[model samples]
Target: MLYAILAYHVEEEVASWTPEEDATVMRDLNKVHGRLNELGRLGPAARLGATEGACVLRGPRKGVVTDGPFTESKEQLLGFYILDCADRDAAISAARDLRQVNPSAMYEIRPVKLYLPGVPFPRTEDGVDA
Candidate 1:
């Protein structure tokens, strides 16, 4: 199974971290990443650019574009990790390890659905599971 571990943190608080603090956090994350790599569980991972560079395109009827994520929340999404694990428990364990090093960071683990060409998606306009 594949799980997406989404990392979240306060933008202002993260930006205010000192050089030493930033280095320490990165060091700890690197250790976790290395362990995942050895286990062949780490897939795609990346730290997103600031929300200032983000934009949201509305549905076709409106077709309007808006700057920023425009979320009604304080914590902003920081990064994400895709882990190939045996099950949800394994994925949760991996996320827990990361949370220990960065207590302020919140991780959301979600199962990933793969989309294949020529295969119909599960949900349809009629609300039936295909």
Candidate 2:
């Protein structure tokens, strides 16, 4: 089965990190990613931008567009990882590996019912995972 590992953290806390601190976390996470990739269990990963530049469309048809990441939770979703695992336990294990490096963050793992990955889009930059 395929699972989505959602990464969440307090925006202020993450935004407070130095460049080096952020890089360290990414490096360690990439190590786990490498192992999973080697096992052919990893899929497309993403790092979302801050809510400051985000918008939300609510209600009917061409709904009203609003600002910010408006979840009721304190922690905002900052990133995600897609993994192919044998079972729920395996999916949780993958999230655990991610949490080991970034202990302060939280993860929510959910099974993927369907994945429709479309044709590749043009690359703008050699940016981070997303």
Candidate 3:
């Protein structure tokens, strides 16, 4: 199975939602997640905190610590989902369904790269080191 990392970005400013509204949206999203689970395609999904709640680490020694998001952008990354699908087309289909539910949000789907067990590095299409 091909694994995809789906990144979701909110299109508008972060506004507080009423408890009822929040529950409704959550229910809708969960329903889709349940379907994916039944198909054995859903791996994991999570909604992350706002950028202000994040911390960044950088440098070879991982000694550099920075505040909040690395950069400021119009849309902030709000959540992500890991999906297992038959192929990229299947992943795209799932993304399209998700987009219909969250019409104002942006979703990015990228294949996840994995190294085979006992392999020191990932393989490349040209048979070169990745």
Candidate 4:
């Protein structure tokens, strides 16, 4: 199964880190990433730009666009990783490893629902998995 691990951290806290501290954190995280890559579990990953440059688009009919990272919380989405895991437990284990490296942030693991070409849409009736 494919899982998306979303990394969230306080923008101020991350931006305030010293250069050495940032490098050390990244080094530790990269160690974990290297292992995952060797195991063929790592997929697409990226570090997002600062939230200040972000824009939100809403209202499909009106196509209204607004500038902001998100309206809900202070913590900004820092990064994400697409991991191929055997199951939910494996994905959680992978997230745990990341949490160890960066203890100040939160990671959200979600299964990816891929829309493949020529595939029938997943049934949404009767509270079934979709």
Candidate 5:
């Protein structure tokens, strides 16, 4: 099964982090990612941009657009991870590992019911989409 781990955090708090602090968190996360890679469970992961640069579209034909995610809560979605897991427990375990290193952030684990079919994006030499 596939799981989507949605990461949510207070935007103001995260944005206030010093570069060193942010880098330290990333390094810690990379340790978790390394283990997932070894298990061949890591899929696509991303750190989303600020909500200020995001838009919400609604209404007919989804043409009604609004600024920001404007979530109903204090936390804004900061990123997500896709993992291939054996079961719900396995998915929860992965989210738990993530939470350990990011105590203040919230991780929402959900089973992926459908994955759109398509070829992956063309990658640059560095293995990232160009």
Candidate 6:
């Protein structure tokens, strides 16, 4: 099965949710998650905290260090799901369903590349890496 990542861009200040509302959303999402699980398509899914909670380390010496996201965009990543699907269309269909649960958010569906030892990377129709 092919894998796809479903990422969401959440408004910085709008990512927070009241405890009550959070519980409600979780209940709804769990229903969908259960359906995916039954289909043997769910891989992983989780909600991330604020960008400020992230730490970046770079270089061999790890001299380059940063807090939160590097961009100045108004939206930051809130969470994501990695799903096993048959194709991009299936991934998009899943994402569209997710959007209905979080209409105010934006989602990006990206295919996950898999590299196995001793096997050449898959190539696209145009000769680009798949």
- Most accurate candidate by TM-score: 2
lDDT of 3 by residue, 19-118 (tens): 6765766677778888898988887566666677688887786578888566565777777778888888898888887776666667888888872335
For model 5, residues 1-130, the per-residue Cα lDDT tens digits are 9999999999999999998998899899989999999999998887877778899887887488889687789999999999999999999999999999999999999999997636676534322445
Model 3, CA-based lDDT: 0.69
- Please write out the lDDT profile of model 4 over residues 1-130, one tens digit for every residue: 9999999999899999998998898899989999999999998776777788799888779788999766577788989999999999999999999999999999999999992336555534222545
> Once model 2 is optimally superposed onto the true structure by TM-score, how far is the C-alpha of residue 61 displaced, in angstroms?
1.4
For each of the candidates, give the backbone clash count: 0, 0, 0, 0, 0, 0
RMSD of every candidate to native, in Å, equals 10.3, 2.3, 10.3, 10.4, 2.9, 10.5
Error of 5 at 35 (Å): 0.5
lDDT of 4: 0.87
Q: Could you tell me the TM-score of candidate 5?
A: 0.90
Displacement of residue 13 (Cα, Å) in model 2 is 0.8
Off by over 4 Å in 6: 11-16, 59-63, 115-130
What digit string (tens of lDDT, one per residue) describes model 1 on residues 54-125?
Answer: 899987887989897877789889899999999999999999999989989999999999822354344332
Worst 10 residues of 6 by lDDT: 120-129
- Better candidate number, 4 or 5, judged by lDDT: 5
Off by over 4 Å in 2: 121-130
| Clash pairs detected, candidate 5 | none
Per-residue lDDT of 1-130 in model 6, one digit per residue for the tens? 5555555565543546776776776677778778888989876565665677687776676478778566665666777777888888898888877777767677878877772435544433212435
